[model samples]
Target: MIKLPTVSLAAIGYEKFLWKNITELLKTGMLIIGIYYCRKIYKKLDDLQKKIDKGEQDKYDFQKKFEYSLDKIKATIDKGEQDKYKIKQEKDNIAQEKDNIALEKELNKEIEQLKKEIERKKAQFKSAWREIPLYADWRKEEFQTVKLTLDAATAHPALFLSEEGRIVTWQEPCQELPSSPERFVSIPCVLGQLYVSSGRYFWEVEVQDAHSWDLGVCRNNVARTGRVTMSPQNGFRVIRLYDGEYWGLTSPETSLTLKEKPCRVGVFLDYEAGDVSFYNMTDESHIYTFSKQAFYGGLRPLFRLWSSDSGPLVIVQVEENTTML
Candidate 1:
């Protein structure tokens, strides 16, 4: 280095002092800049903390809403299941009722069929009893056989009775007979003298020669003075043969069909049983029966000749132990 001039102590001290001052100034400037930058960083951190807190609150609300939605979905599912179970239960009940109705109908049908079968069997038994052999002899032995005859006191004006009171015939001109309370006025009829109150008896009448006749049981106190309708209600349970047709003189007359024309008719009475039955002696076949009659006191055997030209009807006297066949 070139030594030009001599330096003073004061100048050196001054230069040193100046250098120290400048160094201190530079340090202070750097400290101030650091402090400013630190303040800015603190502000940014505070803003970031606020944003984090807001996001946390938002997350909490969203979680609560999601949980509530899940619970609602679960309740809806449970209700749907409950409704489905109830529907199934009702359906099962309806099906059971239908099955019960069907079973009842089947049982009712079976009961009706059984009743019809029983009735048919009863009718068959009755027919068999009539068709058996030796039945006439058995009836004569078992029951009373009466030789019934017409009462002259009960004969009509136009009817003529035999001496033994066993035959009745209608004549053209009515006789001037003495008036009696028991005599038939309008009807050409006659009755038996026996007052049958109870018990069983049978009689036979020959009807082959008679063109038209009426035969049946009647009440002992029946109408004999005036015009009368022959019916069960009118105290007459009779069968009529008019022209060529046979009919039961019921309230509504019942037409009868016969397999063979009846020559001799047998009347069987069961007083206690309220039955009056007729049979054909030729074929031994049952003709008809008047059943369940409400007889109060007594009954009588009635006979009627319809016209003057009607042939004679004879009462067959059945001896004891005699066979009708």
Candidate 2:
């Protein structure tokens, strides 16, 4: 502790010298000096220690509060993320529900339409049966012929006789290039009919060697005849015929590598009004035909394969009106 100034009452006792020295100002100075020294010493030691403790406690408290606030803020952010996820999930669920409903409605509509179609077909069948009383006995006649295989180069080629007895000659590739620079000689029929009926026609050829190619009748060269040519590129195609005045029918719509092996393909023609149908000779199921409208003029209703790629062509007339009746 700090030593304070002590002023005694004897100093102010009433002795002549004491009374002379005992002034009011001296007494007040001594008291004020004792109080200031004691307060200064307290502040330097114990009071300063209390102030430090208070400051540390306040800092600790503030830190704890800050940590709690951070936790709350983090919790709020997490809640927002969770809410977003829930909203997306809800939207997805709603979309799925709508899709399911639409699908069900479409299926129901299709089922009803099918039922109506079935009933209509059944009624039409009954009506047709009633109209044709001799339907069961309606038998078609069949015709047989001696298929001819002719050599057009050596012998004057015999013209193919149609069911109508009209001499119909098909243009075919018959002669092979005799010279070293080999080229094929194509024989094509000049067609007269420009219009066709809605009917199916079949033709066949027996190829012993590689040289058989059929030439189709086209209206004009303007109707580009697509052909999958011997060219490895541009596959099977419809080639423009006679300076673009006709069309050349290619067997396969796409061309494949030609093999040395002998193979035969059958050609089928399905004519419908202005439409001329064609299919691959290898498989009749592959229907590929050009529209008559696309032709410059009209389709020449006649065709023949009379050329040779390497050898002679042996064409067999398989279909006749007598046999097809």
Candidate 3:
């Protein structure tokens, strides 16, 4: 047989040692690579934690700003309520002032009306006191003798005249007197015999128990044939009594309110002065006056009676005054 070379134990041990070193190097390299990978994982987890912390901080800041805005809104609402209350109070004050002004105006108007009424009453009392004494002096100066006699020729047909012609009474339709142009036709009236053209004269007439009568003077040419109104426009100036009322026979008849009715009436005439005055002889009080008239023609005393039952109107003769002006 052919024989080969033999192997040693030391070479086998060296190969074993070399293999052990190479295995140790590989375990060390694997441990280093595992440690590097663990560090990369830790870095990635730390970045994620930082992002979560930043998000929490941003949430906290947003909550703080929202709370501040809510506080501002709450403060504005409180101020608005206070301003509304103040406006309401001011409106109430203005309304009350308007009512007070209206009440003051009504009180002032009533006070003015009362002042006017007090002044009117004072004037009436002063006028009555001044008239009493002035009438007494006028009666003494005007007293005189005047003889009035009725003319039968001019008397109404219904009149009954005394023989002396001093009295006239109204009677029913009597025998017609001779129709003359100067006689009254349908009225109970008569004219005086004496005509007065000038100078002052005084006369008195008794009208006792007469229901109605007219006493005055008329123009001698006055209408004696028809019924005539006893007015100055009809040439008569007179005082009349009818239905218990006295009137001054003027163009527009004037009513007179007398304190007393006179049984006897006195008449005074100033022909040149054109004044006619009447007096109540029972009380010596002046009754009325016809002032400043124009006596154009001759005037005669006139009389009118209501009826026969009304009683006669008598022409009274006064005694002549010895003490004369």
> Could you say which candidate leads in lDDT?
1
RMSD of 1: 9.3
Better of 1 and 2 by TM-score: 1
Give the per-residue lDDT digits (tens) of candidate 2, residues 231-255. 1122122322221132344433333
| Model 1 lDDT per residue over 1-325, tens place | 4332224534556534454565686678778888888888888887888888878888888888888888888888888898888888888888888888888888888888988898889778876776664455456555578878789998999999999999999876898999999899988899987678877778888998687999988998889977799999889988888898888888799898888898988888778878887777877777788757667779999999988767888988878433332
Per-residue lDDT, model 2, residue 298, is: 33
lDDT (0-100) at residue 247 of candidate 2? Answer: 35
Per-model CA lDDT versus the true structure: 0.81, 0.42, 0.77
Deviation (Å) of 97 in candidate 3: 63
lDDT of 3 by residue, 1-325 (tens): 3221123434555534454565676678778887788777787778877888888888888888888888888877777777777777777766766666676677667666666655555544433432464453365465445667999988888888999889888878775689888988867789988688877778888998887888999999888765677787788999998888998998788888777788988887777878787877777666777757789899999888876676888998767653333
Q: Quick one: ranking by TM-score, best first?
A: 1, 3, 2
- True-structure lDDT of candidate 3: 0.77
Can you tell me which runs of candidate 3 are displaced by over 4 Å? 1-140, 321-325
TM-score of 2: 0.29
Q: What is the TM-score of each candidate against the true structure?
A: 0.61, 0.29, 0.57
Model 2 per-residue lDDT at 99: 97
Sort order, lDDT high to low: 1, 3, 2
